[model samples]
Target: MADTQTYKFNVGMTCGGCSNAVNRALTKLDGVSKVDISLETQIVEVQATIPQADVLEAIKKTGKPVTPL
Candidate 1:
């Protein structure tokens, strides 16, 4: 089995809908196992086996700017 990895991103999530958007986008990717977003902190924590670039692209699809942290 592939080792799961966690990545953190500073995103612009202001509410539950924004968080849910991020979750939905990332969860659709094949290797993504989990997605956690904190609207208060504007942080997105993703646990997956996919490449970081792929994850970043998924987040960008939400129309939110994301910075790796």
Candidate 2:
């Protein structure tokens, strides 16, 4: 089995809608086991076995700027 990894991203999320958008986008990607977003902190946490680049691209598709932290 692939190792599970946790990735933290700083995303510009304004509300629940923004966080939900990010969550939806990320959940569509293969190997993404879970997603956790904190609107208050504007942070997105992902648990997955996928590559970081792939995850970044998925988040970008949500139309939000994301930075690795």
Candidate 3:
């Protein structure tokens, strides 16, 4: 089995819907094992076997700006 990685990002999320969208987007991606999002801080932490770039791409699909942390 592949080792899981944790990727953290600062996303431009202003509300619950935005956070939910990001959560859904990441959760749908293969290899993604977990997703934790904070709307107030606009922080997202994803645990997966995928690369950080792939995680970034998934979050970007939500149309939200993302900065790696």
Best by lDDT: 3
| Colliding pairs, model 2 | none
TM-score per prediction, in order, is 0.93, 0.95, 0.97
Candidate 2, residue 32: how far the Cα is off, in Å = 0.6
Ranking by TM-score: 3, 2, 1
Candidate 1 has what TM-score?
0.93
Q: Taking the tens digit of each residue's C-alpha lDDT, what string does model 3 give over 1-69?
A: 999999999999988899999999998999999899988888999999989999999899999999999
Q: Report the lDDT of model 2 for residue 21.
A: 93
Lowest lDDT 10-mer window, candidate 1?
Answer: 12-21
Shift of residue 13 alpha carbon in model 3, Å: 0.3
RMSD of each: 0.8, 0.7, 0.5
Q: Cα lDDT for residue 32, model 2?
A: 98
**Candidate 1 regions with alpha-carbon error over 4 angstroms:** none
Report the number of backbone clashes for model 3.
0
Mind giving the per-residue lDDT tens digits that candidate 1 earns over 1-69? 788999999999888898999999998999999888888999999999988899999999999989999
Question: lDDT of each structure?
Answer: 0.92, 0.93, 0.93
